[model samples]
Target: MELTSGWADPEPMAEGGIAGLSPYLQDRLEREAIPKSGKDALPPEQDRLLDQLLSAAFRE
Candidate 1:
């Protein structure tokens, strides 16, 4: 007969679960997990477009 701790061992995030997801989704999840302030939260497409627009503005 043995007693057990009520709490279960925590699972590691890098080995399974999210590892099963596609790389794109994994990157999205990782980005979402970290909190960002101001403009850092913009999506990659938006950032790229914004950068292109800024460069065009400078070229004019």
Candidate 2:
């Protein structure tokens, strides 16, 4: 997916905001709670549906 803007956005981070966190803390915060189980965890059809939805939403 392409983002029109860079990752840095001031609006998302202000006083008492998530943006002010240290890099280590940010990494921790960004980590997914779910453990990966390789291909067994995801079906190929689900990925196809997600791709279709995103494509439709972002299409000109």
Candidate 3:
């Protein structure tokens, strides 16, 4: 996983997930501007996978 402080060039967290909240927030911000190519889009199961990843990543 990649971690960066700047918002300009945020890096990947997992295989496809972004490292920090910046990229995620940025994607959400420009969501409408971005095209739905349907290729990179995640399936519903991916959301659960992400939850598992995050939970594991931040486990105390």
Q: Give each prediction's root-mean-square deviation over alpha carbons.
A: 11.2, 16.7, 13.7
State TM-scores per candidate: 0.26, 0.26, 0.26
Better of 1 and 2 by TM-score: 1
Evaluate residue 53 in candidate 1 and report its C-alpha lDDT on the 0 to 100 scale: 67
- Tell me the spans in candidate 1 whose CA falls farther than 4 Å from its real position: 1-13, 34-60
Preferred candidate (lDDT higher): 2 or 3: 3
lDDT of 1 by residue, 1-60 (tens): 797768888654432243333456555666788322223333245567579769889995
Q: List the residue pairs that clash in candidate 2.
A: none
Model 1 earns a TM-score of: 0.26
Best candidate per lDDT, number? 1
Residue 35 lDDT in candidate 3: 34
Local distance difference test, per candidate? 0.52, 0.45, 0.50
lDDT of 2 by residue, 1-60 (tens): 877886675434111234233445444555753222332332235576579769889998
lDDT of 3 by residue, 1-60 (tens): 777665677554323323223456446645656432334533336677688779889998
